[model samples]
Target: MPMDSVMGRARALWEGLAQVPVSFAPPGGVDVVVSPRSGLCPDGWVGVVALGGSAIVTAPSDGIAVLVRDALRRLPVEAVTDGALVRQVLPVARVLGPAALSYVSPAGFRAVEAGASSVERLSAAHPDMRRLERSAGYEDAGEAALDEITSPAFVVREHDRVIAAAGYRAWPGRTAHISVLTAPEARGRGLARVTGSLAVAHALAVGMLPQWRARRPDSLRVAAALGFEEMGFQLSVEVEGLSPDFSDAG
Candidate 1:
């Protein structure tokens, strides 16, 4: 299938701009491709898509792509893009499936809308750090926000407690993946959008493209408010359970 037909417009834009290679699988063998391009694996992951007797695989290196190609052989074609099955096979991988939505901001674009005036940049030493740690959204985020607190994090304070927050998980290359959190009691208050705007502004200021991934409609709404355009869904498989290090594979 054409890359545009399979990956959608937004993905094609950046992927084309990055000049990443696109390959079609041959019969009885894996497509086996590796690219360091940030757009292909924005979250530092590898992705494989198997459908209709063809497979498309992307990895940081040829060795990993080969490993994923081999693994894909043991699975049904449907499993190639199945985030759940891929995760089971590669427990260390992060998988994104059709259920996930990917969004990206245009170059030279900054959030023009204003966020909450009460927003404050946060750090590990912030007094509300302890409370933020206990929030449902933070826990659901895999506690990445805690590690990223030293990075560009913004939050909204309510009575000396942080009620919502947003920050970047990692800045790999020129792409920065953003994560947002809002306390359960603070939901529906637009705090996420407010703090998220601050995070996006910070990313743009530093010359990094902001990326947003949302698994729910509510989160998508927040991204839309920040002027993020939906690109496509991403499915990735972790390299866990395999040899801890596959970097040197020949």
Candidate 2:
């Protein structure tokens, strides 16, 4: 697909996910809206997404939305997505991320040639997947969000155990949101890249735009190695008086 077309689809995906009517069109700035139906987050939460210098802010209630809009309306997309700036604006907010948003097109992807024969495709809900997540502990597993994926999991095993895994969940506008996890002891073995490569390839095969939302440096490196282009950033905040229920995050 052409670059413009790919980006158009990406914009549509995020707009749909916002749940409140919004757009990524030009005049590059933020659009703050209050919506109880926001797919970006649940009620009492705040989601800020910036793409190509344009942004959208979704808040759970009118008061919260008004507060955020008054504070961030004058800032550029880059600053709106900045954790420090956001914290300064809302002094008592708990920020979840300023995750780097990346996208891979068929023309931009660089697939890895894997020689690891232990890699196998399995269901994302397989018992072994649970074992792998447990081995990695709750924090890492949750960061990777592997359990939340809907696609087939591409996993690498060592000594009859799943050491690394990758997959993508179907998102709006036919986009694939990639997720990857590796066992604690299996770091630096390139297993993540191999499994991630497989996952990206599969998403591209089905003509879905692949998106990588990375919070860690290592995850960003993997996305870059696979030729995913960093396009923007996303930040989710829990305001001072509004408690965000994270039960749905998993």
| Cα-based TM-score, every candidate | 0.60, 0.92
> What's model 1's lDDT at 188?
88
lDDT of 2 by residue, 115-141 (tens): 844778999889999999999999999
Candidate 2 lDDT score relative to the true structure: 0.85
lDDT of candidate 1 over 22-111, digit per residue (tens): 644453344556665635455446755433345456776666766676666677654566676666655554455543444444442336
lDDT of each: 0.61, 0.85
Q: State the displacement of the C-alpha of residue 157, model 1, in Å, after optimal TM-score superposition.
A: 0.8
Candidate that would win on TM-score: 2
Error of 2 at 88 (Å): 1.2
Displacement of the residue 215 alpha carbon in candidate 1, Å? 2.2
Distance from true position, residue 58, model 2, in Å?
A: 0.9
| List of clashing residue pairs for candidate 2 | none
